[model samples]
Target: MAAKTVTIESKDYVFNTLKEAQNYYDAIVKELYNAKLTLTTGQDFEDLKWIYSTYCHYTKQNLDKLSNSDITGFKGISTVREKGGQYIPTECCAIIFSDSSSNCTEEEFFTDKALKEIAIKQNPR
Candidate 1:
C-alpha cells in the first residue's frame, strides 16, 4: 500500500507503516549517539549503539511479523493521554514504557524460575 502523507501540529511527517516510522526514529538515535549528542564517546557510544541496535533488530523482526492493525495498540483510547503532546505511536512506546495495558512495575511477568534464581542468590547453597 502507498504511504499517505500526513501533517500534525505544524509538522509534516509521513510514514507508511510503523516500520518506516521506526527506521526514521532509529536514524535519529544514530545521529544522537555518533554525532549530535556530544559528550559521551568511545565505549559509551558503542554501548548505546549496541543496546538500541539489539532492541531494534529483534523487535523490528517481530513487528514485521504482525499486521499493521495489531500494532495500533489500545487503538484510540489511552488512560494517561497527554494533551498537546507529540503523540507517540504504539511502536515508539512498546518496550521501556509502562502503561495501563502492560504494567510491569513489579516484574510480574517473571517466570517461576526467576523466583528460584532470586532465592538462590539471596540464600546460596
Candidate 2:
C-alpha cells in the first residue's frame, strides 16, 4: 500500500515506510525540543517541552526496531480544549500522533503520559 500522509499543523509529512515515518516523527520531536528552548517560559514553553519529552519517551527505542504497525498507529492531530469548552491548538508543542484507532481529546493527548507509556509497552521491541 502507498504511504499515508499526516499533517500536524500546516506541515505535511509523507510516510512511504515505517522508517520514513519514524524519522519524521523523531525530527519533529527534536524540532519541538529546540523550539521550546527558544520560548520565554510559561504555558507555551512548557507545552512544547512536554510534547518533546513525551515523544522521546514514546520513541526512545531504536527506530529500526519499530514495525509498520508502530508507525501507522502513531498518527494524530494537535489540538487542546480549554476549561470553557474552547479548543486550542499550539504549534510549539502539540503533536497529534497516536496509535489507538479511537479518537483522543486534547486533554488525553497532552496530559496522558501513562497512556503513551502503555502504548510503548503494547508495541514492544
Candidate 3:
C-alpha cells in the first residue's frame, strides 16, 4: 500500500506519512531552536517538545508499553477548541481526551487558572 500523505499546517510541503511529517516538523523545530526562535507554548517549547516526543514514541512503538509517566507528560497540555473557549487535551491515560462527542459542560475543560495549573503540573521536574 502507498504511504498515507498529509499536508502540514502553515506550510506547503506534503509528507508521505505521519512519521515523515513528524521528521520534517522536528527538523524545523531544531532549526528554530538553533536560531533561538522557539516560542513558548503552554509551558516552554522544550517541555511541549518532550511531551510530543514521548507521545510519538509510544504511538510508533507498542502503545501497550506506555507508562503512567508518558500519559501524564502530555495529558495536561490543553488546546482551545476552534469554536469555543473550552480547553481540550489530546490524550489522558488510555482515553483520547476530547469532550466533543459528549454533553460535556464548559466547566469540564480547563481555562484561566485551571489551565495554568495544568501546564505547571505537566512541566518537567
lDDT of 3 by residue, 1-125 (tens): 44445432223344465455545444544454355452434433333434343444533543332332222222222233433675553311111222334331211121122223333333424
Clashing pairs in 3: none
C-alpha local distance difference test of each model: 0.30, 0.38, 0.35
Backbone clashes for every candidate come to 0, 3, 0
Displacement of the residue 17 alpha carbon in candidate 1, Å:
0.7
TM-score of each: 0.24, 0.23, 0.27
lDDT minimum window of 10 residues, candidate 2: 66-75
Best by lDDT: 2
Candidates sorted by lDDT, descending order?
2, 3, 1
Error of 3 at 113 (Å): 25
Which ten contiguous residues of candidate 3 have the minimum total lDDT?
104-113
> Model 1: how far is 99 from its true place, Å?
24
Quote model 3's TM-score. 0.27
Q: Which tens-of-lDDT digit does each residue in 19-121 have in candidate 1?
A: 4444544444444434424323454333333333333343364333232222111111112323378553221112222344654321111112222332233
